[model samples]
Target: MSKISTDPTRRALNGPTMGTRWTALFHVDPAIDTDPVRAALQAAVDEVDAQMSTWKPDSDLMRLNAAPVGVWQTVPMPLLEVLVLGRDIGLASGGAFDMELGDAVAAWGFGSDTADPVQIRAAMGRHRNTAALEIDVAGARVRKTADVALDLNGIAKGYGVDRLADTLVALDLPAGLVGIDGEMRAMGLRPDAAPWSVAVEAPDPARRSPHSVLALHNAAVATSGDYRHWIDVQGCRLSHTMDPARRAPLVAPPASVTVIARTCAEADAWATALMVLGAEAGATLARQIGLDALFLLRDPTMGFRSKAVGRLFCDQCPEAAAQHAQ
Candidate 1:
């Protein structure tokens, strides 16, 4: 007598959310119907977009923005959670990861509307503070002590990925890899009992390619870079990331910064924070906090170089160094 072993079927599901697509890959029994799973995943990301989108005029976040200062506005639980996390990271990063930069984002044409000079001047001249915002977690409400416009562009898509992961767990799926845009999270090992492979994109506006590869198991990764979205002003190309101090795009920043953390949301926000902090200061903070990050620097002589922090990225440093040495 002999025993037989069968491998589960591989399933890849995707749908649109947050101006991009959300993808989920997993292996499941061949007999299982995936329609319900697809529906659940779509619903999860749709809810996130409904609550946090800056482009949506009537989104929950926009409603909060319209509310009078010093008055509490009730928001959805998920939005509240994200606001709290954003505030915490804002304080930790010393305003490098600001959540109150909606005006600047809109002024610079990164939001739903086109850039306006009047609005740009207003955003640049106005003084703002992250401490002005208040969150009542128990009641799921938030308010502004002064005037502040909150934007979750740096974190929303990652949270959308997290919601997809949660939906899979609720659906009783054992293992999966989920992503929205470039942000990704891996729940468990693959059918072959190996970690998921994700690419760290090179900072090149001309083309899309990987700078390095990472093996992710029960973790998440995110990248913030200057090459993707930008605006041209007076012959200068500026990235979408805003400096809280200048209330404008960063003058000079690293080509890209990648971070790996326990959750996709954390990785996304931290990547932005580190990008604003620049390479030297960012690397120091990344090490102090025990975060795994890789900074891709632009070189006048060489094309690009890397400064890696924490244990996870150290192995990849050698290849980058070797290229520069050549």
Candidate 2:
């Protein structure tokens, strides 16, 4: 907690979306219409779910998935943006964060149904290449050169966070802070002119604890970890973030990966992508792409250790990271 807190009349709102809840911490004046604000916030995220959710059979993403190969299907602007960014990161990460994992995701039981052994057996990794997905940004259209199903599971929640932030901004509360599940975006300072404090969740599956706290201003963060959203297969635990090559949860994955960027969607996708890249390769790619990332890994003998490589983590959380390392 900061020395200063937001206003006494500051309203808090939250509701369900994408199997998780969205939150807003904002201060509104008597002149503001809160009912409309709430509706808008809810609508923004619902629109995203309608467009991107793999669970929804009629979602815009599923429709695109059902489209014939090589056809340039028209997509909404938001979906277009996420698809473009997903592919860009996919290419940059060498398919480590591949967006074309819809089949694999559904096969792993992360989608609308239980895992199918048959689909799991058929799931295969994509050949990394930027040329595989063709996007007409100006026209808001997309085409796939290969038979890859587009899945935005890695990035949609973060985009939802960004949407919440966007709704707040639209209501003229440019300084409000928002969280969707654990993904967060700080629009600006609080009403008291204090930076919003966000907690970085510990990688321990058995406990809900803050590994560290972040002072966020005009930034967004998303964390992808093996701790949550996992299922036990045979005897071992597996994260929902599957490995394309093996058609299973990422093998020997990092405990967690946190990424900060200007947009929550970018943070979301990059976090998943970097997790897939593992600590070494992911860190290198983050540095190359000028992204801020903190990687938490288990040291064989030393236990939990964090390796942070990015301008944001290095600058804002230097002291916190140091204390955690100790």
Candidate 3:
């Protein structure tokens, strides 16, 4: 009988750049070289940062913002796709997730600069431009009747995670988990034949404990919250998530919203939309749209509380089902 060759599997790779860390893990032959895979994954991440980063004035997003209205300015394909998706989601969620909030985000100090009172007022008074904008993806262009600035901060990271995972798979490593910041995508099962486990961080600024853990087989997870990026003005805390209608921070803070979906982009947008909608309406809408989501709210007296929506959490949380029954 011929002896069989058995090879150990390589599982994890990590690199730091783009203001955050990029992590990749796969169950692949350990004997197979992984340096090329690492390099390709990092390159894909760099491409995403270059195209969508608001911190970079020369980024494609900024170029699109500065471009003249009603003109078909050619832009990189990735940016064009993200913008197109933003438009679709904005309309789908009734403008809850607006990409035309660049001015608002920057004015609120969510961008690369400090908060400016003048910009904040202007951003608040500015009319929403997303409702009037149109995108032509096939033509690789966009047009706006009114002055509108685009920001992909909400969806870009998740999209980047998806891009990274796709890059790994294209390089013949189909079983891997790719993550940037907190947004992540799991391509296949781990080497132990178990689903990839990810922790959903608690929204408590004072606590680093994870509130919930998810077992992802082949899916993407994205979380949006008010805890990380915020401003304090006269003892009032303000989050980066702007209400498009008011063009300011959300009046009521939602501790956090975590979404698990088929694609990172969808999960990202859904998380933002839920944040904007607040807990009650957001939960209702999420169920109506059949989204898998977890909404965490901060209590004035109690530290934190949570609610789960959709089928994904049905098996995980019996309380969610019990609450639904009542």
Candidate 4:
């Protein structure tokens, strides 16, 4: 006679979306079939990509972009929700995280086409007037009061991650961790009753490695950094994140900024906002808003130095400070 183990089987699944991959991790009974769950996950992300992708000319976002200013455009509820949230974050971040930078993004080669000097000059010369977006929630429509090219690249993936988590819950599968690219959301604890462990990637383009780790349960985390995507111009390496005021890439920004929030969408947008604000101003805003954020700065001598705000990160600053100092 032999004793049998009663532990649930761990499962990991991933699929392509947004030129990257979306992933789900969980534990369930070994006998349970996962095909339905997998399909649901894929469908959830597909819906997001269809509605929000700037690369797709037929996407709802592009349709709105093409629409003449001041004319209302009908949008799906999901897209509407994202648009509303993007506007809110833009206001909250004091225009640091702008959605109306699509022109600048496309001109810089971060969008559908390669960089164009002619378009870049035009983008840079434009005055900074944040768009006035109007949302009719009941009608599920949105309109812009001015000429603005909207982009949701900063927040869409986070919302996609949220959808994955929601999909898992709808399927009656709790206890899971879901992510699109590096933006992640954690549901209930693992089968063994532990929070999901997520790594904060180091801002090193040469290699992939962890700078720190977070234990998340019912929370989400996201990071914005300079290393992952960039372009070279006149011997200068510029990050993909644009400065809304200048309508150009940030000249000086943190190596990376990581944010933890109740929703992945909030986390993702704030990370980008903080990157624009830099460590000093960002730390102030994070503290004022009760946000948990970690700023990694490039230090010539120490390699990387960190500045943390909010209780979650400050509580662990001693360790992070020591590690980053070296």
Q: Which candidate tops TM-score? A: 4
* Tens-digit lDDT track of model 3 for 1-326: 22233444656887764578988877766567888888888888889889998888998878878887777677789888888788888888889999889888998888888999999999898866656566777888777667788788899988889888999889877777889888988888776777787888888787687776777878898999989878998899988898989999997768889888888988999899999998888888888888888888887787677777888755358233211110
Tens digits of per-residue lDDT for model 4, 1-326: 22243557899999999999999999887778999999999999999999999999999999999999889899999999998888899999999999999999999999989999999999999887765678999999999888888899999999999999999999999889999989999998887777888888889999999998888889999999999999999899999999999999998799999999999999999999999999999999999999989998899999998888877788457234211100
Q: Which 10 successive residues of model 2 have the least lDDT summed?
A: 317-326
Q: Give one digit per residue, the lDDT tens place, for model 1 in 1-326.
A: 22222458899999999888999999987779999999999999989999999989899999999899999999999999899989999888988999999999999899988999999999999987758888999988989998888899999988899999999989998689999989999888898888888888889999999887888888888999999999999999999999999999998899999888988999999999999999999998998899888899899898998889877877356433211100
Each candidate's lDDT (Cα)?
Answer: 0.89, 0.83, 0.82, 0.90
Native-referenced Cα lDDT, model 1:
0.89
In model 4, the Cα lDDT at residue 210 comes to 90
TM agreement with the true structure for every prediction = 0.95, 0.91, 0.92, 0.96
In order of listing, the candidates' clash counts read 0, 0, 0, 0
Off by over 4 Å in 3: 1-5, 315-326
Residues 83-169 of candidate 2 have per-residue lDDT tens digits of 888888777777777777778888888888898888877785434333567999999999878777788989999999988998888
RMSD of 1: 3.6
Instruction: Name the candidate, 2 or 3, with the larger lDDT value.
Output: 2
Clashes of 2: 0
Indicate the residue-level lDDT of 17 in model 2.
95
Say which candidate scores most in lDDT.
Answer: 4
Candidate 2, residue 53: how far the Cα is off, in Å: 0.6
Candidate 1, run of 10 with poorest lDDT? 317-326
TM-score of 2: 0.91
The deviation in Å at residue 115 for candidate 3 is: 0.4
